[model samples]
Each structure stands twice: as structure tokens, then as C-alpha cells.
Target: MPTAYRLLLPLGLALLSACAHQPGSLAVHQQSQCPLSLRSGQQVILTLPSNPTTGFRWVLRDGASSLLDSLGPEVYSNPEDAGLIGSAGQSTWRFQARQAGAGHLLLTYQRPWETEVAPAKTFDCPLRVQ
Candidate 1:
């Protein structure tokens, strides 16, 4: 084989090996339906639209801890034009698939202080961890 070809082949294989060990993340939005599948140790982010000024927030109705582990608490971010009043932002939750099993996540957007009213929005995700 040519010396140039030998040198390039080793470099290419090394780069691919490095990438294989890196962790991966998946992002799911409100429009996305449930029954999602993921490999073990992969991370998933659930993002939903929210406007806290109106007293509506996304709360986790149910979390299947046996199949997934919470990376941390949920996070919220506002749009770049934040000066506008009553503008909506994004709320995101991060979780890591821990084992091989089926699980579900339920979330609702509602006012915590109000009990009788129904949620303004909801996210229901059924998950399979492999």
C-alpha cells in the first residue's frame, strides 16, 4: 500500500473510535407523541412552551424512576426579546435512560394554586429503554 494511504487510514479510524465513546442526547418537543425508544445511558430532553407570567407552568405528573434517572431539575429559558410582557418561553427537563425497560412520563401545564381547573397543556411520553 502507498505510505499516504496507510497514514490516512489510521487517522480516520482513530477519529471514529473517539466519537463512538461520546454520549448522545435526544430532544423531544410538545408536538411529538409518546412511545419513544432509546438506548441505555442516552440522555433525553423534554421541552415545552410555557409562560410563567400567566401562572401556568409545566409540572411532572408522573416520572418512571426505575427506567430513567433525572439529570437535574427542570430548566426554563426566555426568548431573546424578553422585554415584551407576557411572552412565552421554553421549559426543558433532562433525563438519562438507566436500564432496559418500559416507562412513561406525564407532565401538565397548569396553575399550581388552582385545583379545580384543568391543565392548559399536557405532555405524555411513553418510553422504551434498551
Candidate 2:
């Protein structure tokens, strides 16, 4: 093989090998991505539309604790460039696949004080880890 071809072949193979072995994080934005399939040690990121200024918040009812581990509490971020009060934002939660199992990651959006009332919105996603 030519000198340049020999050098390029190993570099290309190295990159392909790295990608094949790396477990990438899975991002879930809506219910359409339900029945998530993840590998052990892979990160799972869940983001949902939220507007906490309206007194509604997404509460974690089930986090698939047996199959995944929570990385941290929910994170809320608003678009600073919007420059408007009570603007809609997003809430994000992170988790890591722990073991081979299946469960549901469920959340309800509603006012915490109104226990008697039903949730305004619900997000329930089934998760499978291997």
C-alpha cells in the first residue's frame, strides 16, 4: 500500500471502532419517543415543554428506578433572548441506564397544591435497558 493510504486506513478504522464502542446518550422530547431502548451505562435525557410561571410543574411519579438512576433533579431553562415574563420554557431530567430491565418514566404536569384536581398533562414513557 502507498504510504498515505496505509496511514489513512488505520486512522479511519480507529474512528469507526471508537464509535462502535461508545454508548451515546438518548434524548427524549415527546411521547412519540416512547418505549425507549438503552444500553447499560448510557445516559438518557428527557426534556419537556414547561411554563412554571403558570403554577404548573412536571412532577416525577415514576422514574424507572429499577432500570435507571437519576443523574439529578429537574432543570428549568427559559429563553433569555425572549425577554418576556411568563414565557414558556423547558424542563430537563437526566438519568443513566443501570441494569437490564423495563419500567416506565412517568410525569404529571399540574399544580402541586390542587391535589383533588387531575393533572393538566401527563407524560408516560416506557423504558427498556439492556
Candidate 3:
């Protein structure tokens, strides 16, 4: 093998390794990435599209409390450039993998007062911590 080829091979491997998931945290944005695999003590950040101005709120149904612990309450943030009122934003929740187990993180988007109405949307993701 050429000397330059040998040198570049190691550099390529290093870059590939850096692209893997980080050790201490993982960010999830969509349900397609569900059935998450996490290491113990790793942080899980979940963000979903939301707009409370429409009278719909993301309510936590199952938080996977058996294997994960909530780090804080839901946080909502709107884009700074979208100066208009009632614009869509995002809702984020933070959690930490506490033990080796499997569970599901579930949430529904619905109006709090509309008990008779079904949720407009739902987010359910399976989680595995090891």
C-alpha cells in the first residue's frame, strides 16, 4: 500500500468515529428515530412542534419514568424572526436515563378543557436504556 494511502486511512476512520452518537446526550426530533438506545446517565432531549396559541398543548401521558427521570418541565420557544403572534414554535422536554430498562415516552397534543374531543396529534417513542 502507498504511504499516503495508509496515512489517510487513519484520518478517515477518526472522522467516522466522531460522527457516532455522543456519550452523554442524545437529541430526538422525530418519531421515526424511535426505539432509542441510550447509555445509563445519558441525557435525552426531546423537541416537538407546538403552538399553544391554538389552544393546544403537549401533555405528557407516559414519561418512561421507570427507566428515565425528568430533568425539567416542558419549555416553549418561538423563533425570534417570526414576529407575528400565534406562530408555531417548539416544545422541549429533558430527561436522563436512570437505569437499565425499556419504556415509552408518550405525549398528546390537545386542548386541556376539551375532555370530549380527541387529541389532534400524538408523539410516542420507545426507549431502551442500558
Top candidate (TM-score): 2
Summarize candidate 2's per-residue lDDT along 7-32 as a digit string, tens digits.
99999999999889878999999999
lDDT of 1 at 40: 92
- lDDT for each residue of candidate 1 in 1-130, tens digit (9 for 90 to 100): 9999999999999999998986799888865656789899899998888899899998898877998899999898888878787799999999999999997898989999997999988788889998
| Tens-digit lDDT string for candidate 3 (24-71) | 779999999998999998999999999999999999999999999999
Better of 1 and 3 by lDDT: 3
TM-score of each: 0.80, 0.83, 0.81
CA displacement after TM-score superposition, residue 2 of candidate 3 (Å): 52
Worst 10 residues of 3 by lDDT: 16-25
In model 3, pairs of residues that clash are none
Report every candidate's CA lDDT. 0.88, 0.95, 0.93
User: For candidate 3, what is the TM-score?
Assistant: 0.81
Between candidates 2 and 3, the one scoring higher on lDDT is 2
Q: Which of the predicted structures, 1 or 2, would earn the higher lDDT when compared with the native?
A: 2
Number of clashing pairs per prediction, in order: 0, 0, 0
